[model samples]
Target: MSLRFSDTVHGVDLPNNAMLPPFDDAWVTSWGAERRDGIYVSRPMTLQVFHTRLLEHAKCNNVTERFGVTRDTGAPAVSDGILWGVASWGIRKLCGTERFPAMFSYLASKSNLDFLTNGTQILMSDKRHYPYPDNLFNNRAETTPPSTTS
Candidate 1:
C-alpha cells in the first residue's frame, strides 16, 4: 500500500515545496540577529516528530517509484526529481536518539549554517529534529534545560 501522510508517520502532507514558506518565515522572524539565527532550534515536540515523519516517508516510498533511475542499458523506470539525499539527512535527524559530533555536521550542512559559529554548534548539541509536515519546521531545540550546568 502507498504511504499516506498520516499512516506512515507523524506528518501532514502538504503542497509542493511546502517547507519553503515556513523556513522563510522562520528566517524572517530572526532577521535582526547579527549572527546566524537562521539555524533553528529543535526540541522533542518539533524536531524529533518532524524528522521521524520524513524518514518514514522515505523508507515507505520507493526511490525508483518517486524518482526514476536509469539502467546500464539507459532504460528509465522513473524520472529525475528533488534531491533525495537531503531528505535522507532529515530522516537521520529524526531517527537520531543521542547527540553526537556528526549530527552537528549533518544539520550544519542541511540548514546551511556556518561551521565556525559557536552558537550553531551549541544549538546542535541542545536541540533535536522531528518529523513534520512537508519538511516544514522539523526541529524544536529545547530552549531551557531542567537545570543549567556550569
Candidate 2:
C-alpha cells in the first residue's frame, strides 16, 4: 500500500504528499549506531516484547512483505523496514534486564519523532501524489500473543 495523507485541518488544505517517509538506508545506519553505542539500552524481555509488538503490527497491517517477513518463516526475513533492523539487533544483544520501561518508552518516542521530523519534506512546488485512504492507523487493534500449549 502507498503512503499518503490529505486532510484539511482548520479549513486549510493539507498537502497530499505528506506521506510517511520510507525507511531507507539512513535509518538503517542510525539503528546500527544506536546498537553500537547503547544509546537506547533495552533488556532481553523488553526487546522480545517490542519485537512481538512490531511483528504483530506488521501482520495486522498486512505489510509483512514490506518488512521482509513471510508466512512460512514467521520471522523477520530481512532488515529492510525500520523496526526490523532494531528488533534483529536487540535479539542479538540479549542484554540483562534493567530499565525495561525506559527502553520501551524510548522506542515509542523515537518512532513518533521520526515520523514527524524525518518523514515530512516540503517542496516549493505542489506536485505530489496522494494514495487513497488505506485505513492504516485504524487497523492498530490489540493483538493477542501467541498461545502456548504444553
Candidate 3:
C-alpha cells in the first residue's frame, strides 16, 4: 500500500545533500480527545519522525516549508509559546481510499486542533533540543506558498 500526503508548504529552510533515517525507531503520540455533548472523541495519532538524519532527508525531498518571523513586533511578555515554522504532511494510500481520509479526519477531530491548519513542517538545525528524537521535529518540504509577515 502506498500512502502519500501532499500540501502547499511555507516557512522552511532546506538542507543540502541529506538523507533520512529509518522509521522503525520513530515515535508516535496522540493529543487526546475533545469533549462534545458529554462525550470524548478519539484523537488521531500523529507519527513523529525525529531522527535528525531523517529530518535532513525530508528537507531535501521538498516536503517542508521555511519561513522567517517578523521580529519587529515587540517580543511576547512570556518570551515563549510562539510558532516559528510549520510541518505539513501528505498521506498517500495504496488501498482503501474512501476510508483513509474519513478515518484520519475523525481521529484529528478529537484533538481539538484543526487538522488542516496544524499540519506538519520540516525542522531546522536549531530546533533539535529534545534528548529523545520526536516526530514533531522531523518534517518534509512541500510546494506550498511561503509565509512572510510584512
Candidate 4:
C-alpha cells in the first residue's frame, strides 16, 4: 500500500525532494512557512511542527522499510532523499538522535532571516532548490557542555 498523509511510523513518514510542493507525491508530504517576528526567540508553529516530526521519525525508526519504494534501480531500499540528509544536523543536536548527516552550510555572507520574514512569496518559486523552501533561520555551532572542573 502507498503511504498517505496520515500514515505514521511513530507519527511521521520519510521524505524526498519530490515531496516538495509542485512536486509532492503519494509517499511524501509538504508544507510552507510564513513570516513572523521574534523569529529567534519565538518558534513559528509551522517550523516547530516540521523539526519535531523529523525527530519523531528518527526515534527507533532508523531507515524503516515503511518508507521504502520500489524505484531505486529495480530494487527497493529505504528512501534517502536530499531533504532527510539536509535537516539531520540540527535535529540530531537538539535531541541526541542521529538521522541523516547535514549537507547544508551556514552562509556567513548572507542571512535567510531577512527574506523569510519579508518575502512576498511563502516559498521560493524554484521550490526544489536547497535553502529555498528550507529557509534556514539559524544555525548553532557544535558546542561542548560546560566543564565543572575549576
Best-fitting candidate, scored by TM-score: 2
Q: Give each model's whole-structure lDDT.
A: 0.22, 0.26, 0.24, 0.26
**Who is ahead in lDDT, 1 or 3?**
3
Model 2: lDDT to the true structure: 0.26
* 1-150 per-residue lDDT for model 4 (tens digits): 965554342222223222322222112222222323412233235412222122221243452212211111111111223223222122322222233322222221123323432463333222233322332323332222223378
Q: Compared with the true structure, what per-residue lDDT tens digits does model 1 show for residues 19-135?
A: 222221010001111212333343223211111111232333322211111111111111021111222222222222222101111122233323323453432222223322433
In TM-score terms, candidate 1 sits at 0.15
lDDT of 2 by residue, 1-150 (tens): 964555621211122222322222311111222233544443233212112233322333342221211111222222223222222222223332221111111122223434534665422112333232224433232322222355
Give the runs in model 2 whose Cα sits over 4 Å from its true position: 1-27, 31-57, 60-121, 124-128, 139-150
- Write candidate 3's Cα lDDT for 9-43 as tens digits: 32232211121122222221223333344344544
Candidate 3 vs candidate 4, TM-score winner? 3
Best by lDDT: 2
Scored against the true structure, residue 55 in model 2 reaches a CA lDDT of 31
Worst 10 residues of 4 by lDDT: 68-77
> Each prediction's TM-score against the native?
0.15, 0.22, 0.19, 0.17
Please report how far candidate 1 places residue 110 from its true position, in Å. Answer: 7.7
